[model samples]
Target: MSAVTVGQELASVPYDELIKNILLAMVAAQNEANASFIEGINDLVGTEVKIKYKEDSTEKEISGNALAFGILPTLLQIQSGIIEIKMAITLQQTREFQVGVKARMGFRVFSASVDAKYQNTYSYKVEGSSLVRIQVAPAPPPQPLMRAIEYIASKTAPTIP
Candidate 1:
């Protein structure tokens, strides 16, 4: 059988809260130039575009800090019913895990590492005085393996005894 491993879970924050916070962080990061463009688009689109995370938490705690990373376009252009913002923010964190094993004969201990990344996309329109139709797309999912461990079971079940 293959070995089983799991990562550490956050203490008390809900997933939705995490995503909301991250999205807010992304919006706050936008500079004046891009913010103006976002506002303009909101005016054109009737409905506001917002970002929603499919999972519980889009923000991962790595090391000791809470970080949000993403990409935004340096220049934004609204033309022919299409709006584009071009830039990127790459955020990542590393965590460590400890594993312990006890058996009839002895005990063993080891460590594993896990890393996570979050990428955000900023594009929006200005409707009236409010920024509407804000769309934020998360980057691809984080990889599962931050570290790898391998071990042989004692005698491999003895070949069916």
Candidate 2:
């Protein structure tokens, strides 16, 4: 019996379908990230900070949003939060053929006959990996939005006498 193996493309899974599924998952992840970022901004906006000072024979106190310290740096981080995902997939299929032969020899009337058989089998393997990277270098916030946050910060900031 002789066995032969041949490499072939995987028939069950297609690259396009795999990529489409990956894209769908990425969309869902992006949605979740958006929700989380919104929650973070809301929390930051609600946070409060205070400062106190003493003047000659007098005491004064000031109150402001926590972001008042540095709206540009604080909001820059929040608004710049971004993420990217990459994926690699490999699919393999193999076909193996096993051949068998049986022979009979006879001296009567010098007659000979032979019989042969072959069997084919298939096997499949799939390998996949993914990489995730986060990018925080998003473009700067719009001027109007920055101005508004700065205004809020200035209004809430504590005063020193």
Candidate 3:
């Protein structure tokens, strides 16, 4: 409703020019917000902090995206010998961030991956003993008392005819 009102108010401007103006305004607003947010991040750069965001970069004509992470060292005891990672955020500062954006954007759209599988899966209770069969089952682990008793009997028992 408010958007509609604002659009109606801007009707005096030409349609194409109005759209361009709106986009320009949006970009300006985004940059200002980002600068302020980065400044905040810079404040706690030397401290232990974990921040998660999406990184996008373009090199030549190719572009890629990934989950960007920033972690600060937690061990203050070893600060003398250890190198700590810090973040710097400056409001309205002139900086060309070619590395990528560090903003937290919600609900990024991604294409479904084609049958990517996870690694390190183990199944203990297999049914088929053959070469080409896969089985999955859940079995309880052996009890410690029974194992101890078996061990003692084996060690102490004498041979019988």
Ranking by lDDT: 2, 3, 1
- Write the residue-wise lDDT of candidate 3 on 1-161 in tens digits: 13223222322333234335545655565556555644544443323323234447522222111111222122111111212212111122213442443323321111111111211122212231112111222223325633643554455333221
Q: What lDDT would candidate 3 get against the real structure?
A: 0.30
How big is the positional error of residue 50 in model 2, measured in Å on the Cα after superposition? 1.3
Which pairs, if any, clash in model 2? 62-158, 64-156
Q: Taking the candidates one at a time, how many backbone clashes does each contain?
A: 25, 2, 4
Estimate, for each residue in 13-51, the C-alpha lDDT of model 1 and write its tens digit: 233344455566664654454567445433423232234
- Alpha-carbon local distance difference test for all models: 0.29, 0.44, 0.30
lDDT by residue for model 2 (42-158), tens: 566677666677778577777656566553333213344445433333333323232331112211111101111111222211122244444443344457755776777677664
The 10-residue segment with the lowest total lDDT in model 2: 106-115
- The number of the candidate with the highest lDDT is 2
- Give the Cα-based TM-score of candidate 1 against the true structure: 0.19
Q: What is the lDDT, from 0 to 100, of the residue 90 in candidate 1? A: 17
